[model samples]
Every structure is written in C-alpha cells, then in structure tokens.
Target: MRSRAGLVAVCGAMLAAAVALPLGGTAYAADTAGATDAARTAAADTPSALVLTLSPGESAQTVGVERAVTLTCTPSPGGSHPAPQEACAELSAADGDLAALPAQPQSFCAMIYAPVVVTVQGAWQGERVDYARSFPNECVMRAQGGPLYAF
Candidate 1:
C-alpha cells in the first residue's frame, strides 16, 4: 500500500512539470509577437520621403486648363540631393476662372499627387521651390512630365 502511494505522488509531479514548461514557452512566444507588431506600427507612421504642403499663395495664373504643381523634393529619411516632387491639383470652375483672369491673379494650393519614390542620390535638406506648369491632357501630361502638379 505504501509503495503504491509513493508511485502515485511521483507520477503527479512529473505531469505537473510537463504542463508548466509548455505554458512558460507559450508566454514567451506571445511576448515576442507583441513586440514585433508594435515595431511595424511605428515604422508605418514615420514618413519615408519629404512632403510639401500647398498653400493658396503658391499657385500660378493660367487659362483654359489647370496648372501642374511640382514640389521641390528634399532629403527624405536618407537622401543627398534635391529632387522635383510632382503632385496634382484639381481646379474647380472658380479655380479655372481664377487661372484665366490676368487682372484677378488667381492662386492655387499644393497637394500630394503620387507615392514618393526613393533615389540613389536621395533628397536635399532645405527650402526649395518648384514651379507647376499647365498641361492640356492629364494622362499624357503625367506620362511626359514624369512628376507634375494639377490645379
């Protein structure tokens, strides 16, 4: 009877250890996964390229169609030279008239036109201005202009 009781006690301890070990490993894995997810979220929020904000003062006067606006690209997180960042602005009826009127002198704002591209030369750090030109056809204009702004 005594030997049987001792055997039962030993078996119970072995089972408990086996279960506890696996649970501890699972907890460690969960912690690692959580850390990885947080890191990814942080990276996504940071801007990888330089961005330009369009203001009413920057737009140029035009007639018949809208004008193409380009941002002066600066150094992204890692860049060396200044590059032209092209974006598009949609001109409303009011905007069109503003563009046409020589006396009134209409102004348009700037906005992001496309996803930023990275280059080997990268971007420069400083305040630079790029002019936005008017184009007749958007598709053709974008293709030919490479990067362009619309207003």
Candidate 2:
C-alpha cells in the first residue's frame, strides 16, 4: 500500500510538471497574451526590409558579376541602393509589379548568351513582394532596366 501511494504521488508530480512546463517553457495565459501583443505591436511599428540581389546565371558566362542591395520602401525608400528615390518612384508607379517596370529604349546589343538573374524580396506598397527573373544576357537585362535594376 505504501509503494502504491508513493507511485501515485510521483505520477501526480510528473503530471503537474508536464502541465506547468510546456515545450516553450512556462505556459501562462496572461504572459503568452502579453508576448503575442508585443510581437504584434513590433511588427505593426516596424517597416519591412527589402532584399535585392543580382547574380550571374549558372552558365559560366560573366567572370565576376554579383551585387546585392537592400531597401526599405515603406515610409520612404532608402537603403544601400544607389538611387533610392527614383527606385521607389518606379516601384510605386508599377504598384510593386516588377514585370510592369518600363523597358529601356531599344538599343544595339550583342548576341551574347550570358544570363543574368535579378531577385527582389520583401514587402512593397503594403503587399509582400518576392521576385526573381532571368534574362538571356546583360544586354537584355539592361534593356529591361528601370531604377530597380540599374545597379
């Protein structure tokens, strides 16, 4: 009877510990609610960071052509990018549509087959934007260049 009572107490203690200690640590309704509220407030108050990258495609073409730039277009457009205001204006005009950006005027381009890839990640105009596109050559990419790809 003594052993049975001890086993029952141990099991009760284990159960209590399990209930009190969740996977993420202590589980308290008020504390969890406060944490969630703080996270929400932080996200609401923080502006999204834009990540842009330019790289040479896997064609063994360009020897060394890689560039990366980050921009925050919300509240204002600013970051490591060279022309923030113009880039922001272009993006805003396109409504965050990468493909909608106007193509540069027609120009003579060599028939090279080197591919270039452009990637943009982040939010724009209160909407999430993740864009990646490949062009057949630097010339073609430049042909499609707006302030977004001027780098």
Candidate 3:
C-alpha cells in the first residue's frame, strides 16, 4: 500500500512538471514569456538590413554590368537603394517575403532570353534571408519585383 501511494504521488509530480513546462524549454510560463518578449523587442529595435545584388549575366546592358545596394527598412528605411521609400513600402506590404511580391499584370516584356540574376542577402526583420532568382530580362525583373529591384 505504501509503495502504490508513493508511485501515484511521483506520477502526479511528473505530470505537474510536464504541464508547467513551456514547450519543455523553460520550466515556467513567466520565464519563457519574458525571454521571448526580450528577443522580440531586440529584433524590433535593430534596424533591418538587406543587400540587393543584380548581375547582367546575359543582358544587353552596356553601362553597368553589376550593381549592389544596401537597404534598411526599420528606423526609417535608410539605405543606398534608388527608391528606398517605395522599396521599403513594397517589402513591408509583402511581410518581408520577397518571393511573395505580386507581379504586375499589365507590364509587358520582350521574349529575349537575356538572363539577369539577382540576389538578396542579409536579414529582414531579424529573419535571415538568402534569396536568388534569374529573370529572363531586366524588364521582367522590374515588373515582378517592383521598386525593390529598380535600384
């Protein structure tokens, strides 16, 4: 009888511990919530940074072969991007997901197979981003990416 009672108490204690644990990380809600809030606040305060690179691999452009620029959305969208305001707005509208940016429907481009590769490297809203894509031409890139790639 004594052993059975001890076993039941131990099982109850274990169940209580499991219930109190937050995702099995911190042992309590208060601690986990505080840490999560601190991390979110830090991320928000830090200026979001991203580097945009465009390479005219097979494009017929003559003046600039390769171009790159730094973009910061937070702390007022300060960067070397040509259209920083528009770019930042578009990015925010898309929730930092570059691939989700909507493409313009009315925009038309030539069928030339001039491949222009573009890359975005860095962090967006504290989330690491490494995006790369090859557009058939610069026009398609602009039509699809909007002011974000207009730089």
Query: For each candidate, what is the lDDT?
Result: 0.35, 0.75, 0.85
Which structure among the candidates has the greatest lDDT? Answer: 3
What TM-score would each prediction reach against the true structure? 0.21, 0.60, 0.69
Q: After superposition, how far is residue 84 of candidate 3 from its true place, in Å?
A: 0.6
Total backbone clashes of model 3? Answer: 0
By lDDT, is 1 or 2 better?
2
RMSD to true structure for each model, in Å: 18.1, 9.3, 7.5
Residue-wise C-alpha lDDT for candidate 2, range 14-122, written one tens digit per residue? 9998886776364576678999888766654456567877788843234343888888766666899898888877776775678898887766689888888888888
Taking the tens digit of each residue's C-alpha lDDT, what string does model 1 give over 19-117?
Answer: 898879978898889897887565444333323222222233312222222233222222221233322111111222222222212333244443222
* Clash count, one per candidate: 12, 0, 0
Using TM-score as the measure, name the better of candidate 2 and candidate 3.
3
Q: How much is 21 displaced in model 3, in angstroms?
A: 8.5
Q: Candidate 3: what lDDT? A: 0.85
| Weakest ten-residue segment in model 2 by summed lDDT | 57-66
- TM value for model 2: 0.60
